[model samples]
Target: MSLLDIDGVSVDLGRAPLTRVLDEVSLRLRAGEVVGVVGESGSGKTTLARSILRSVPVAAGSLRIDGRDVRGLRGGTLRAWRREGAVQYVFQDPLRSLDPGVRVVDSIAEGLRIARVPSEERTRRIAAALRDVGLDPELAGRLPGHLSGGQRQRAAIARALVMQPRLLLLDEPVSALDAASRDRIIRTLIALRDAHRERLGMLVISHDIGSLAALSDRLVVLYRGRIVEDGPTRQVVARPRHPYTRLLIASVPVIGVAGADRTERAALRAAIDA
Candidate 1:
Protein backbone atom coordinates (compact mmCIF):
# COMPACT_ATOMS: atom_id res chain seq x y z
CA MET A 1 0.00 0.00 0.00
CA SER A 2 1.06 3.55 -0.61
CA LEU A 3 2.20 5.63 2.35
CA LEU A 4 -0.28 8.36 1.43
CA ASP A 5 -3.33 8.14 -0.79
CA ILE A 6 -5.79 10.82 -1.87
CA ASP A 7 -8.70 9.60 -3.93
CA GLY A 8 -11.45 11.61 -5.57
CA VAL A 9 -10.82 14.46 -3.14
CA SER A 10 -12.75 17.71 -3.58
CA VAL A 11 -12.85 20.99 -1.68
CA ASP A 12 -15.12 24.03 -1.90
CA LEU A 13 -15.78 27.25 -0.03
CA GLY A 14 -19.26 27.87 1.35
CA ARG A 15 -22.44 27.42 -0.70
CA ALA A 16 -21.23 29.29 -3.73
CA PRO A 17 -22.57 26.77 -6.22
CA LEU A 18 -20.13 24.16 -4.87
CA THR A 19 -17.44 25.39 -7.19
CA ARG A 20 -15.15 22.41 -7.44
CA VAL A 21 -11.67 23.66 -6.66
CA LEU A 22 -10.43 20.10 -6.97
CA ASP A 23 -12.34 17.76 -9.19
CA GLU A 24 -11.81 14.16 -8.21
CA VAL A 25 -8.11 14.68 -7.70
CA SER A 26 -6.36 11.41 -6.96
CA LEU A 27 -2.74 10.77 -6.04
CA ARG A 28 -0.56 8.22 -4.29
CA LEU A 29 2.88 8.43 -2.70
CA ARG A 30 5.05 5.57 -1.64
CA ALA A 31 7.60 5.69 1.13
CA GLY A 32 10.58 7.87 0.11
CA GLU A 33 9.11 8.90 -3.23
CA VAL A 34 8.88 12.61 -3.98
CA VAL A 35 5.85 13.71 -5.99
CA GLY A 36 5.50 17.19 -7.44
CA VAL A 37 2.23 18.97 -8.02
CA VAL A 38 2.78 21.74 -10.58
CA GLY A 39 0.40 24.44 -11.72
CA GLU A 40 -0.10 28.17 -12.05
CA SER A 41 -1.69 30.24 -9.29
CA GLY A 42 -5.28 29.24 -8.37
CA SER A 43 -4.86 25.79 -9.85
CA GLY A 44 -5.91 24.19 -6.53
CA LYS A 45 -2.45 22.94 -5.51
CA THR A 46 -2.67 24.64 -2.11
CA THR A 47 -6.21 23.39 -1.66
CA LEU A 48 -5.03 19.83 -2.22
CA ALA A 49 -2.28 20.21 0.37
CA ARG A 50 -4.66 21.69 2.92
CA SER A 51 -7.15 18.93 2.31
CA ILE A 52 -4.54 16.23 2.86
CA LEU A 53 -3.40 17.87 6.10
CA ARG A 54 -7.08 18.17 7.23
CA SER A 55 -6.77 21.96 7.64
CA VAL A 56 -9.26 22.55 4.84
CA PRO A 57 -12.42 20.48 5.07
CA VAL A 58 -12.68 17.79 2.48
CA ALA A 59 -15.96 18.38 0.71
CA ALA A 60 -15.95 14.88 -0.73
CA GLY A 61 -13.86 11.69 -1.10
CA SER A 62 -11.12 9.88 0.77
CA LEU A 63 -7.75 10.75 2.30
CA ARG A 64 -5.71 7.97 3.78
CA ILE A 65 -2.35 7.77 5.51
CA ASP A 66 -0.54 4.48 5.75
CA GLY A 67 -3.70 2.69 4.55
CA ARG A 68 -5.97 4.12 7.27
CA ASP A 69 -8.92 6.17 6.00
CA VAL A 70 -9.02 9.71 7.43
CA ARG A 71 -11.96 11.24 5.60
CA GLY A 72 -14.31 10.84 8.53
CA LEU A 73 -12.03 11.75 11.44
CA ARG A 74 -13.27 14.62 13.60
CA GLY A 75 -12.60 16.67 16.70
CA GLY A 76 -10.29 14.80 19.09
CA THR A 77 -9.59 12.05 16.61
CA LEU A 78 -8.40 14.57 14.03
CA ARG A 79 -6.29 16.38 16.59
CA ALA A 80 -4.78 13.11 17.71
CA TRP A 81 -4.09 12.12 14.13
CA ARG A 82 -2.21 15.35 13.52
CA ARG A 83 -0.29 15.06 16.78
CA GLU A 84 0.73 11.53 15.88
CA GLY A 85 2.63 13.02 12.96
CA ALA A 86 0.82 11.19 10.20
CA VAL A 87 1.52 14.19 8.01
CA GLN A 88 3.45 17.45 8.31
CA TYR A 89 3.27 20.65 6.27
CA VAL A 90 5.99 23.15 5.34
CA PHE A 91 4.44 26.41 4.20
CA GLN A 92 5.77 28.71 1.50
CA ASP A 93 6.38 31.59 3.90
CA PRO A 94 8.41 30.44 6.87
CA LEU A 95 7.75 33.70 8.71
CA ARG A 96 4.01 33.24 8.46
CA SER A 97 4.23 29.69 9.78
CA LEU A 98 6.73 30.38 12.60
CA ASP A 99 6.39 32.26 15.87
CA PRO A 100 8.45 35.44 15.92
CA GLY A 101 8.74 35.38 19.72
CA VAL A 102 9.73 31.73 20.07
CA ARG A 103 13.36 30.64 20.06
CA VAL A 104 14.34 28.40 17.18
CA VAL A 105 15.03 25.47 19.50
CA ASP A 106 11.69 25.85 21.22
CA SER A 107 9.88 25.79 17.89
CA ILE A 108 11.65 22.59 16.87
CA ALA A 109 11.12 21.07 20.29
CA GLU A 110 7.39 21.71 20.12
CA GLY A 111 6.92 18.77 17.77
CA LEU A 112 8.78 16.46 20.13
CA ARG A 113 6.54 17.65 22.93
CA ILE A 114 3.46 16.86 20.89
CA ALA A 115 4.81 13.39 20.29
CA ARG A 116 5.58 13.00 23.99
CA VAL A 117 9.30 12.65 23.62
CA PRO A 118 11.24 12.74 26.89
CA SER A 119 12.83 16.09 27.73
CA GLU A 120 16.43 14.92 27.36
CA GLU A 121 15.69 13.10 24.12
CA ARG A 122 13.78 16.10 22.78
CA THR A 123 16.76 18.33 23.45
CA ARG A 124 19.09 15.97 21.66
CA ARG A 125 16.64 15.61 18.76
CA ILE A 126 16.15 19.35 18.45
CA ALA A 127 19.87 19.90 18.17
CA ALA A 128 20.17 17.13 15.61
CA ALA A 129 17.24 18.51 13.63
CA LEU A 130 18.81 21.94 13.60
CA ARG A 131 22.09 20.47 12.39
CA ASP A 132 20.25 18.37 9.80
CA VAL A 133 18.83 21.50 8.25
CA GLY A 134 22.31 23.03 8.15
CA LEU A 135 21.68 25.54 10.93
CA ASP A 136 24.36 26.19 13.53
CA PRO A 137 23.62 24.84 17.01
CA GLU A 138 24.34 28.33 18.34
CA LEU A 139 21.29 29.69 16.51
CA ALA A 140 18.99 27.55 18.60
CA GLY A 141 18.45 30.33 21.13
CA ARG A 142 17.74 32.99 18.52
CA LEU A 143 14.21 34.15 17.76
CA PRO A 144 12.77 33.98 14.27
CA GLY A 145 13.10 37.76 13.90
CA HIS A 146 16.84 37.50 14.46
CA LEU A 147 17.39 34.99 11.70
CA SER A 148 17.69 35.53 7.95
CA GLY A 149 14.89 34.32 5.67
CA GLY A 150 16.87 31.21 4.81
CA GLN A 151 17.55 30.45 8.45
CA ARG A 152 13.90 30.89 9.31
CA GLN A 153 12.99 28.38 6.62
CA ARG A 154 15.55 25.96 7.96
CA ALA A 155 13.98 26.28 11.37
CA ALA A 156 10.56 25.56 9.93
CA ILE A 157 11.92 22.47 8.23
CA ALA A 158 13.53 21.39 11.48
CA ARG A 159 10.26 21.84 13.32
CA ALA A 160 8.59 19.47 10.90
CA LEU A 161 11.48 17.03 10.97
CA VAL A 162 11.38 16.77 14.74
CA MET A 163 8.00 15.09 14.39
CA GLN A 164 9.47 12.25 12.31
CA PRO A 165 6.38 12.46 10.16
CA ARG A 166 5.56 9.77 7.65
CA LEU A 167 4.41 12.17 4.98
CA LEU A 168 5.68 15.74 4.37
CA LEU A 169 3.69 18.30 2.42
CA LEU A 170 5.74 21.17 1.01
CA ASP A 171 3.69 24.06 -0.35
CA GLU A 172 5.85 26.12 -2.69
CA PRO A 173 8.67 25.84 -0.16
CA VAL A 174 11.30 27.78 -2.14
CA SER A 175 9.06 30.39 -3.76
CA ALA A 176 9.75 33.03 -1.11
CA LEU A 177 13.56 32.75 -1.14
CA ASP A 178 16.17 34.47 -3.27
CA ALA A 179 17.73 32.36 -6.02
CA ALA A 180 20.83 31.41 -4.07
CA SER A 181 18.94 30.65 -0.89
CA ARG A 182 16.45 28.60 -2.84
CA ASP A 183 19.24 26.52 -4.30
CA ARG A 184 20.74 25.97 -0.89
CA ILE A 185 17.38 24.98 0.59
CA ILE A 186 16.70 22.62 -2.27
CA ARG A 187 19.98 20.83 -1.73
CA THR A 188 19.32 20.62 1.97
CA LEU A 189 15.91 19.12 1.31
CA ILE A 190 17.40 16.56 -1.07
CA ALA A 191 19.92 15.55 1.55
CA LEU A 192 17.26 15.32 4.22
CA ARG A 193 15.11 13.13 1.99
CA ASP A 194 18.01 10.81 1.37
CA ALA A 195 18.73 10.52 5.08
CA HIS A 196 15.09 9.85 5.99
CA ARG A 197 14.10 7.72 3.02
CA GLU A 198 12.83 4.81 5.05
CA ARG A 199 10.56 6.96 7.22
CA LEU A 200 9.19 9.67 4.92
CA GLY A 201 7.01 10.43 1.93
CA MET A 202 6.82 13.85 0.26
CA LEU A 203 4.38 15.83 -1.84
CA VAL A 204 5.88 19.05 -3.16
CA ILE A 205 3.73 21.80 -4.63
CA SER A 206 5.33 24.45 -6.82
CA HIS A 207 4.86 26.54 -9.97
CA ASP A 208 8.54 26.44 -10.90
CA ILE A 209 8.81 23.60 -13.37
CA GLY A 210 12.58 23.41 -13.17
CA SER A 211 12.65 23.01 -9.39
CA LEU A 212 9.83 20.48 -9.50
CA ALA A 213 11.65 18.54 -12.18
CA ALA A 214 14.77 18.50 -10.08
CA LEU A 215 13.12 16.97 -7.01
CA SER A 216 10.20 14.86 -8.15
CA ASP A 217 10.18 11.21 -9.15
CA ARG A 218 6.76 11.77 -10.69
CA LEU A 219 4.85 14.90 -11.77
CA VAL A 220 1.21 15.87 -11.88
CA VAL A 221 0.12 19.04 -13.69
CA LEU A 222 -2.96 20.89 -12.53
CA TYR A 223 -4.97 23.33 -14.66
CA ARG A 224 -8.29 25.05 -14.04
CA GLY A 225 -8.72 23.07 -10.82
CA ARG A 226 -8.17 19.70 -12.45
CA ILE A 227 -5.20 17.52 -13.32
CA VAL A 228 -4.30 17.93 -16.96
CA GLU A 229 -1.29 15.64 -17.00
CA ASP A 230 0.22 13.00 -14.73
CA GLY A 231 3.33 11.04 -15.62
CA PRO A 232 6.99 10.44 -14.98
CA THR A 233 9.02 13.63 -14.63
CA ARG A 234 11.16 13.04 -17.66
CA GLN A 235 8.10 12.23 -19.80
CA VAL A 236 6.27 15.33 -18.63
CA VAL A 237 9.27 17.56 -19.16
CA ALA A 238 10.43 16.20 -22.50
CA ARG A 239 7.05 15.38 -24.04
CA PRO A 240 4.25 17.27 -22.36
CA ARG A 241 0.89 15.83 -23.38
CA HIS A 242 -1.68 18.48 -22.53
CA PRO A 243 -2.07 21.75 -24.39
CA TYR A 244 -1.75 23.74 -21.19
CA THR A 245 1.40 21.86 -20.25
CA ARG A 246 2.88 22.60 -23.68
CA LEU A 247 1.97 26.25 -23.31
CA LEU A 248 3.65 26.41 -19.91
CA ILE A 249 6.81 24.87 -21.32
CA ALA A 250 6.82 27.20 -24.29
CA SER A 251 6.38 30.29 -22.16
CA VAL A 252 9.65 29.62 -20.34
CA PRO A 253 12.24 32.01 -21.77
CA VAL A 254 14.89 30.24 -23.80
CA ILE A 255 18.42 31.53 -24.02
CA GLY A 256 19.72 32.50 -27.47
CA VAL A 257 16.22 33.04 -28.82
CA ALA A 258 16.45 36.48 -30.50
CA GLY A 259 13.66 39.08 -30.20
CA ALA A 260 12.43 38.40 -33.73
CA ASP A 261 12.53 34.69 -33.07
CA ARG A 262 10.12 35.30 -30.19
CA THR A 263 7.67 37.07 -32.48
CA GLU A 264 3.92 36.57 -32.54
CA ARG A 265 4.19 34.75 -35.84
CA ALA A 266 6.36 32.05 -34.33
CA ALA A 267 4.13 31.80 -31.27
CA LEU A 268 1.05 31.58 -33.50
CA ARG A 269 2.41 28.63 -35.41
CA ALA A 270 3.51 26.93 -32.18
CA ALA A 271 0.11 27.48 -30.61
CA ILE A 272 -1.62 26.09 -33.66
CA ASP A 273 0.46 22.93 -33.58
CA ALA A 274 0.17 22.62 -29.81
Candidate 2:
Protein backbone atom coordinates (compact mmCIF):
# COMPACT_ATOMS: atom_id res chain seq x y z
CA MET A 1 0.00 0.00 0.00
CA SER A 2 1.11 3.57 -0.58
CA LEU A 3 2.56 5.38 2.40
CA LEU A 4 0.57 8.53 1.68
CA ASP A 5 -2.78 8.70 -0.09
CA ILE A 6 -4.68 11.87 -0.94
CA ASP A 7 -7.83 11.12 -2.90
CA GLY A 8 -10.10 13.67 -4.49
CA VAL A 9 -9.14 16.12 -1.78
CA SER A 10 -10.40 19.70 -1.92
CA VAL A 11 -9.43 22.75 0.12
CA ASP A 12 -11.14 26.10 0.67
CA LEU A 13 -8.97 28.92 1.99
CA GLY A 14 -11.92 30.77 3.57
CA ARG A 15 -11.91 33.77 1.29
CA ALA A 16 -15.16 35.80 1.26
CA PRO A 17 -16.41 33.85 -1.76
CA LEU A 18 -15.06 30.55 -0.42
CA THR A 19 -13.24 29.28 -3.48
CA ARG A 20 -11.61 25.88 -3.50
CA VAL A 21 -7.85 26.21 -3.39
CA LEU A 22 -7.35 22.50 -4.09
CA ASP A 23 -9.89 21.00 -6.47
CA GLU A 24 -10.44 17.30 -6.12
CA VAL A 25 -6.77 16.42 -6.23
CA SER A 26 -5.71 12.79 -5.95
CA LEU A 27 -2.10 11.64 -5.54
CA ARG A 28 -0.30 8.61 -4.15
CA LEU A 29 3.28 8.39 -2.96
CA ARG A 30 4.37 4.88 -2.22
CA ALA A 31 7.24 3.93 0.03
CA GLY A 32 10.61 4.52 -1.66
CA GLU A 33 9.26 6.88 -4.31
CA VAL A 34 9.35 10.63 -4.90
CA VAL A 35 6.58 12.66 -6.56
CA GLY A 36 7.11 16.23 -7.64
CA VAL A 37 4.30 18.80 -7.78
CA VAL A 38 4.99 21.66 -10.22
CA GLY A 39 3.10 24.88 -10.93
CA GLU A 40 3.43 28.66 -10.89
CA SER A 41 3.11 30.73 -7.75
CA GLY A 42 -0.25 30.43 -5.94
CA SER A 43 -1.15 27.32 -7.90
CA GLY A 44 -2.17 25.80 -4.57
CA LYS A 45 1.21 24.05 -4.42
CA THR A 46 1.77 25.05 -0.80
CA THR A 47 -1.86 24.27 0.05
CA LEU A 48 -1.48 20.71 -1.21
CA ALA A 49 1.59 20.21 1.01
CA ARG A 50 -0.32 21.56 4.02
CA SER A 51 -3.29 19.39 3.20
CA ILE A 52 -1.14 16.32 3.76
CA LEU A 53 0.06 17.70 7.12
CA ARG A 54 -3.58 18.49 8.06
CA SER A 55 -2.61 22.11 8.61
CA VAL A 56 -5.21 23.09 6.01
CA PRO A 57 -8.71 21.75 6.48
CA VAL A 58 -10.30 19.80 3.67
CA ALA A 59 -13.76 20.61 2.42
CA ALA A 60 -14.41 17.34 0.60
CA GLY A 61 -12.83 13.98 -0.26
CA SER A 62 -10.41 11.98 1.82
CA LEU A 63 -6.75 12.10 2.82
CA ARG A 64 -4.95 9.19 4.41
CA ILE A 65 -1.60 8.17 5.82
CA ASP A 66 -0.74 4.53 6.64
CA GLY A 67 -4.34 3.59 5.72
CA ARG A 68 -5.88 5.93 8.33
CA ASP A 69 -8.13 8.63 6.89
CA VAL A 70 -6.73 11.85 8.24
CA ARG A 71 -9.90 13.74 7.34
CA GLY A 72 -11.75 11.76 9.98
CA LEU A 73 -9.20 12.53 12.71
CA ARG A 74 -9.99 15.60 14.77
CA GLY A 75 -8.77 17.61 17.78
CA GLY A 76 -6.44 15.58 19.93
CA THR A 77 -6.28 12.68 17.48
CA LEU A 78 -5.24 14.94 14.62
CA ARG A 79 -2.66 16.72 16.76
CA ALA A 80 -1.37 13.37 17.89
CA TRP A 81 -0.89 12.24 14.32
CA ARG A 82 1.22 15.30 13.58
CA ARG A 83 3.24 14.77 16.73
CA GLU A 84 3.86 11.13 15.97
CA GLY A 85 6.20 12.11 13.16
CA ALA A 86 4.48 9.93 10.62
CA VAL A 87 5.20 12.85 8.32
CA GLN A 88 7.43 15.93 8.39
CA TYR A 89 7.81 19.17 6.37
CA VAL A 90 11.10 20.74 5.27
CA PHE A 91 10.53 24.42 4.61
CA GLN A 92 11.82 26.38 1.59
CA ASP A 93 14.06 28.67 3.62
CA PRO A 94 16.15 26.62 6.01
CA LEU A 95 17.50 29.72 7.73
CA ARG A 96 14.04 30.91 8.61
CA SER A 97 12.94 27.46 9.75
CA LEU A 98 15.92 27.31 12.15
CA ASP A 99 16.90 29.69 14.90
CA PRO A 100 20.25 31.46 14.65
CA GLY A 101 20.94 31.03 18.33
CA VAL A 102 20.22 27.32 18.52
CA ARG A 103 22.88 24.66 18.00
CA VAL A 104 22.32 22.57 14.89
CA VAL A 105 22.05 19.38 16.93
CA ASP A 106 19.61 20.99 19.35
CA SER A 107 17.35 22.03 16.48
CA ILE A 108 17.27 18.43 15.31
CA ALA A 109 16.82 17.12 18.85
CA GLU A 110 13.88 19.35 19.76
CA GLY A 111 11.33 16.96 18.28
CA LEU A 112 12.90 14.00 20.01
CA ARG A 113 12.87 15.89 23.29
CA ILE A 114 9.18 16.77 22.91
CA ALA A 115 8.38 13.15 22.18
CA ARG A 116 10.36 12.33 25.34
CA VAL A 117 12.91 10.14 23.63
CA PRO A 118 15.65 9.07 26.05
CA SER A 119 18.43 11.66 26.26
CA GLU A 120 21.11 9.22 25.13
CA GLU A 121 18.99 7.92 22.30
CA ARG A 122 18.17 11.44 21.15
CA THR A 123 21.86 12.24 21.05
CA ARG A 124 22.59 9.09 19.08
CA ARG A 125 19.81 9.75 16.56
CA ILE A 126 20.92 13.36 16.11
CA ALA A 127 24.39 12.29 15.00
CA ALA A 128 23.05 9.64 12.66
CA ALA A 129 20.63 12.09 11.07
CA LEU A 130 23.43 14.55 10.47
CA ARG A 131 25.53 11.85 8.84
CA ASP A 132 22.59 10.76 6.71
CA VAL A 133 22.37 14.23 5.23
CA GLY A 134 26.09 14.20 4.31
CA LEU A 135 27.26 16.41 7.18
CA ASP A 136 29.99 15.96 9.73
CA PRO A 137 28.49 14.76 13.01
CA GLU A 138 30.77 17.18 14.84
CA LEU A 139 29.15 20.24 13.21
CA ALA A 140 26.03 19.62 15.24
CA GLY A 141 27.51 21.87 17.92
CA ARG A 142 27.68 24.89 15.60
CA LEU A 143 24.93 27.53 15.38
CA PRO A 144 22.87 27.97 12.22
CA GLY A 145 24.79 31.16 11.35
CA HIS A 146 28.03 29.18 11.26
CA LEU A 147 26.85 26.92 8.43
CA SER A 148 26.66 27.67 4.74
CA GLY A 149 23.30 27.95 2.99
CA GLY A 150 23.66 24.42 1.65
CA GLN A 151 24.77 23.16 5.05
CA ARG A 152 21.84 24.82 6.81
CA GLN A 153 19.45 23.17 4.39
CA ARG A 154 21.09 19.83 5.06
CA ALA A 155 20.61 20.45 8.78
CA ALA A 156 16.91 21.09 8.16
CA ILE A 157 16.66 17.83 6.26
CA ALA A 158 18.54 16.14 9.09
CA ARG A 159 16.00 17.48 11.55
CA ALA A 160 13.19 15.91 9.54
CA LEU A 161 15.03 12.59 9.20
CA VAL A 162 15.65 12.56 12.96
CA MET A 163 11.92 12.10 13.45
CA GLN A 164 12.11 8.86 11.46
CA PRO A 165 9.21 9.96 9.31
CA ARG A 166 7.85 7.64 6.69
CA LEU A 167 7.01 10.52 4.41
CA LEU A 168 8.79 13.81 3.74
CA LEU A 169 7.15 16.98 2.40
CA LEU A 170 9.74 19.18 0.73
CA ASP A 171 8.53 22.64 -0.29
CA GLU A 172 10.79 24.46 -2.78
CA PRO A 173 13.69 22.97 -0.90
CA VAL A 174 16.30 23.94 -3.49
CA SER A 175 14.68 27.02 -4.96
CA ALA A 176 16.68 29.36 -2.75
CA LEU A 177 20.14 27.95 -3.44
CA ASP A 178 22.65 28.65 -6.17
CA ALA A 179 23.34 26.01 -8.81
CA ALA A 180 26.22 24.45 -6.88
CA SER A 181 24.37 24.43 -3.58
CA ARG A 182 21.21 23.20 -5.21
CA ASP A 183 23.09 20.30 -6.77
CA ARG A 184 24.67 19.45 -3.42
CA ILE A 185 21.32 19.43 -1.63
CA ILE A 186 19.79 17.25 -4.33
CA ARG A 187 22.71 14.81 -4.08
CA THR A 188 22.18 14.62 -0.32
CA LEU A 189 18.50 13.85 -0.84
CA ILE A 190 19.38 11.08 -3.30
CA ALA A 191 21.83 9.65 -0.78
CA LEU A 192 19.22 9.67 1.96
CA ARG A 193 16.78 7.88 -0.32
CA ASP A 194 19.37 5.25 -1.18
CA ALA A 195 20.44 4.80 2.44
CA HIS A 196 16.97 4.06 3.76
CA ARG A 197 16.14 0.36 3.71
CA GLU A 198 12.43 1.10 3.40
CA ARG A 199 11.04 3.26 0.68
CA LEU A 200 10.82 6.84 1.98
CA GLY A 201 7.89 8.45 0.20
CA MET A 202 8.46 12.11 -0.67
CA LEU A 203 6.31 14.93 -2.01
CA VAL A 204 8.51 17.64 -3.49
CA ILE A 205 6.74 20.89 -4.40
CA SER A 206 8.66 23.19 -6.71
CA HIS A 207 8.56 25.44 -9.80
CA ASP A 208 11.99 24.20 -10.89
CA ILE A 209 11.21 21.46 -13.38
CA GLY A 210 14.84 20.64 -14.11
CA SER A 211 15.64 19.92 -10.49
CA LEU A 212 12.41 18.00 -10.04
CA ALA A 213 13.30 15.98 -13.13
CA ALA A 214 16.52 14.97 -11.44
CA LEU A 215 14.78 13.74 -8.28
CA SER A 216 11.16 12.73 -8.90
CA ASP A 217 9.87 9.47 -10.24
CA ARG A 218 6.63 11.18 -11.23
CA LEU A 219 5.63 14.72 -12.05
CA VAL A 220 2.20 16.16 -11.25
CA VAL A 221 1.39 19.37 -13.07
CA LEU A 222 -1.13 21.52 -11.26
CA TYR A 223 -3.10 24.26 -13.05
CA ARG A 224 -4.94 26.71 -10.84
CA GLY A 225 -6.27 24.20 -8.30
CA ARG A 226 -6.66 21.14 -10.52
CA ILE A 227 -4.44 18.26 -11.50
CA VAL A 228 -3.85 18.58 -15.21
CA GLU A 229 -1.09 16.02 -15.53
CA ASP A 230 0.12 13.07 -13.45
CA GLY A 231 2.39 10.36 -14.82
CA PRO A 232 5.95 9.17 -15.01
CA THR A 233 8.15 12.26 -15.22
CA ARG A 234 9.67 11.25 -18.53
CA GLN A 235 6.34 10.43 -20.15
CA VAL A 236 4.70 13.68 -19.15
CA VAL A 237 7.72 15.82 -19.96
CA ALA A 238 8.36 14.25 -23.35
CA ARG A 239 4.81 14.46 -24.55
CA PRO A 240 2.75 16.79 -22.37
CA ARG A 241 -1.00 16.37 -23.02
CA HIS A 242 -2.54 19.24 -21.13
CA PRO A 243 -2.45 22.71 -22.66
CA TYR A 244 -1.29 24.12 -19.35
CA THR A 245 1.46 21.54 -19.27
CA ARG A 246 2.58 22.50 -22.76
CA LEU A 247 2.52 26.15 -21.77
CA LEU A 248 4.71 25.36 -18.82
CA ILE A 249 7.24 23.53 -20.98
CA ALA A 250 7.23 26.31 -23.56
CA SER A 251 7.88 28.86 -20.85
CA VAL A 252 11.23 27.45 -19.72
CA PRO A 253 14.03 29.68 -20.96
CA VAL A 254 16.18 28.61 -23.88
CA ILE A 255 19.71 27.58 -22.94
CA GLY A 256 22.20 30.43 -23.17
CA VAL A 257 25.96 30.46 -23.91
CA ALA A 258 27.00 31.02 -20.31
CA GLY A 259 26.24 27.41 -19.41
CA ALA A 260 24.70 26.62 -22.75
CA ASP A 261 26.78 23.81 -24.13
CA ARG A 262 25.46 20.68 -25.79
CA THR A 263 25.54 19.16 -22.34
CA GLU A 264 23.21 21.75 -20.83
CA ARG A 265 20.85 21.53 -23.79
CA ALA A 266 20.79 17.75 -23.59
CA ALA A 267 20.20 17.76 -19.86
CA LEU A 268 17.35 20.22 -20.30
CA ARG A 269 16.07 18.15 -23.19
CA ALA A 270 16.33 14.90 -21.22
CA ALA A 271 14.35 16.62 -18.47
CA ILE A 272 11.39 16.52 -20.89
CA ASP A 273 12.32 14.00 -23.57
CA ALA A 274 12.26 10.24 -23.83
User: Highest TM-score among the candidates is held by which one?
Assistant: 1
* TM-score computed on alpha carbons, candidate 2: 0.90
Candidate 1 per-residue lDDT, tens place, 1-274, comes to 9998888888886585777788889888998888999998999999999888888888788989999988889999989888897688998888766888888788778777877899989888887888889998788688989988888888899888888889989999998898898988888888888988998888999998778877888999998678889998888978877766765665554311123234644664476456
| Residue 230, model 1: Cα distance from true site in angstroms | 1.1
Best by lDDT: 2
How accurate locally, in lDDT, is each candidate?
Answer: 0.83, 0.85
TM-score of every candidate relative to the true structure: 0.91, 0.90
Q: Residue 169 in model 1: shift from native, Å?
A: 0.6
Residue 94 lDDT in model 1? 87
Q: How many backbone clashes does candidate 1 have?
A: 0
Model 2 spans > 4 angstroms off: 253-274
In model 2, the Cα lDDT at residue 110 comes to: 88
